[model samples]
Target: MKEEMINIQDPILQLKDVSISYSPGKNAVKNIYADIAKNKITAIMGPSGCGKSTLLRAINRMHELYPDIKIMGEILLDGKNILKMNPMEVRRMAGMVFQRPNPFPTMSIFDNVIAGYKLNGISLSKSEKEEIVERCLTNVGLWNEVKDSLYKKGTFLSGGQQQRLCIARALALKPDVLLMDEPTSALDPIATNRIEELLLDLKQEFTIVIVTHNMSQAARISDYSMFMYLGELVEYDTTQTMFTNPKDKRTNEYLSGQFG
Candidate 1:
């Protein structure tokens, strides 16, 4: 079925006829076309192996890490086609946070936040690094908690704090969009609530595309929502509309707890 469309006056990102395949003639994500509005929280929800993560990873060309995977599409970020851009540059513009908190085990809290600049071979002076570290940590609401322990290893922090630190690391690059894959899944309820609140604040500054399995989370935080099933986009609409009056039978079923 064709995905529902909503007119976005000036979308920050556009996915045009996107498809991904792990093997020949077998696509994990079928052609998907959508316009992502600026500074809004958009959620992608679907059952396992439905290509939510595959589609998200393709936004920043993460699929390039595997030799056999193939992606065909035009992913435009701020009017530039990211598919043809340098992978490193694409990643910097659209920073990603994974399902679990993955702070570099070897790096300290301060160093982890600026890891992107170091990895990109971009040099920063002592003061510049300090400024970025503080700003990013403050953005993720982790500054005061770990301020005194800036030199401590990131892995020493709690799961939720580590995830926030990971977010701070991603934000340090000053990305245009933030891509999250089940970011709060590994944390406790309190921690999850904190991350949700953080995301709400973040949408004011950055466009967010999150792949989540939790429908409640989507309803609570997303401005727009996409429901994908079996590699195809089943529906896309405002969270309120989609929840109360979905256009597709599959979407209604999924939302009704009839199926995952």
Candidate 2:
């Protein structure tokens, strides 16, 4: 089934003249202004070195973790500037998944799902933790596969299963937006397809912004698409329009067989 089209005005996250630099005098992301809609999937696609991952990190303030990195302009979540919010709070509001699945190797599958709350010093009863685990794992389609093995180490799962578990971990926090960087790139085709299906289902509850180099994957899952080149957002439109009738020549060239 086709996802409902989100009105452009309904933004959950907004970037206003946002720019990021790893060092003085060199910007990795430049003057980006885009609005991501609620309960929709947005794909950020560009060639290598195009600042896709850099911009994704900025949304949740991951850029602040590194020394010598600087960010300018506003990133708003529900009309509030995230730059002014506590980093931990920003991260809790917007969860992230990396290219590689990195569940805590020593932790059990069940423990990994509720690790966020534990690490953040948020207390919950055993029943509450169990409820969170089951709810999140079920949402990510991992509960059925790993229910009996909840006490086993997380690293024992396959790459796809581990990735799904990581997603469950993120979902346990009840985040409003999910930021994924090349989420399915490390998985096999079957696993990638499963993750894609999971993402489609997830958008009904969470706004998702995923960075993917795979054009076919972006076309398959994203409701809206953003094309970036040389640190600039070249075009943004509904996926249907961006793929079929992009307004920018650069977007057309990138969508075509020309330069990425």
Candidate 3:
């Protein structure tokens, strides 16, 4: 299928002929080329096992956790190829939030927000740590609610609060891009709405790339939309255009509930 293209003047992330394979001769993500605009929310939508999560994980080098996974082509972040950069640095620059809220069970809310810094062995003065914790928590709209309970374990918060805390942790690193893999799929409707609102607010400062199964959520929150099928990017356009006038048969079918 011919993919629709859009011009981005100064994209923060560029995927050039990117492909991933879990095993030899079996590509899971096939030759995707996209230039993701900065400070915008781009939603990747598709059915199960269509490589949306695989592509999102590659942005932060999460696939490295499995040595068998192989990735090819250049994933550029801020004009530098992230595939060539150190995984630690790449991850720090492209922070991720998973499908579910996963705060460290043993750590306090404050500690969870700064977990990335500690895990990376980056030291900061007590004052600096306090500042970062407060700033990040405030950013995710958790500070006022959790300030009195900062020392409580992060897992103690409600599911939505925990997810927000996870988002705060990602923000603590001040990443250039925020990669979310179905961030709201595990939350209640109320919680999901909060996250959607937070994401909109967040795009003002950080670029967002999200993989979502919920087309409504994608339409509601994303500025741009990408539809993938069978490991291939089938269409990409502004959210307004793609949802109302999708170019590909697959995209239209998926949007119309004819198929996933």
Candidate 3's residue-wise lDDT over 140-175, tens digit each? 999999999999999999999999999999999999
Clashes of 2: 0
Q: TM-scores, in order shown? A: 0.98, 0.96, 0.98
Candidate 1 positional error at 8, Å: 1.3
How does model 2 score by TM-score?
0.96
Give the TM-score (vs. native) of candidate 1.
Answer: 0.98
In the range 78-132, model 1's lDDT, one tens digit per residue, is: 9999989999899999999999999999999999999999988999999999999
lDDT of each candidate versus the true structure:
0.95, 0.93, 0.96
How many clashing residue pairs are found in candidate 1?
0
lDDT of 2 by residue, 1-260 (tens): 12222347779998888889988989999988888999999999999899999999999999887989999989999898999999999999999999999999989999999999999999999999999999999999999999999999999999999999999999999999999999999999999999999999999999999999999899999999999999988888899999999988988888896986
Ten-residue region with minimum lDDT total, candidate 3? 1-10
**Candidate 2 residue-wise lDDT at 4:** 20
Model 3: runs farther than 4 Å from truth?
Answer: 1-4
lDDT of 1: 0.95
For model 1, the superposed segments whose C-alpha errors exceed 4 Å read 1-4
Point out the higher-scoring one by lDDT: 1 or 3.
3
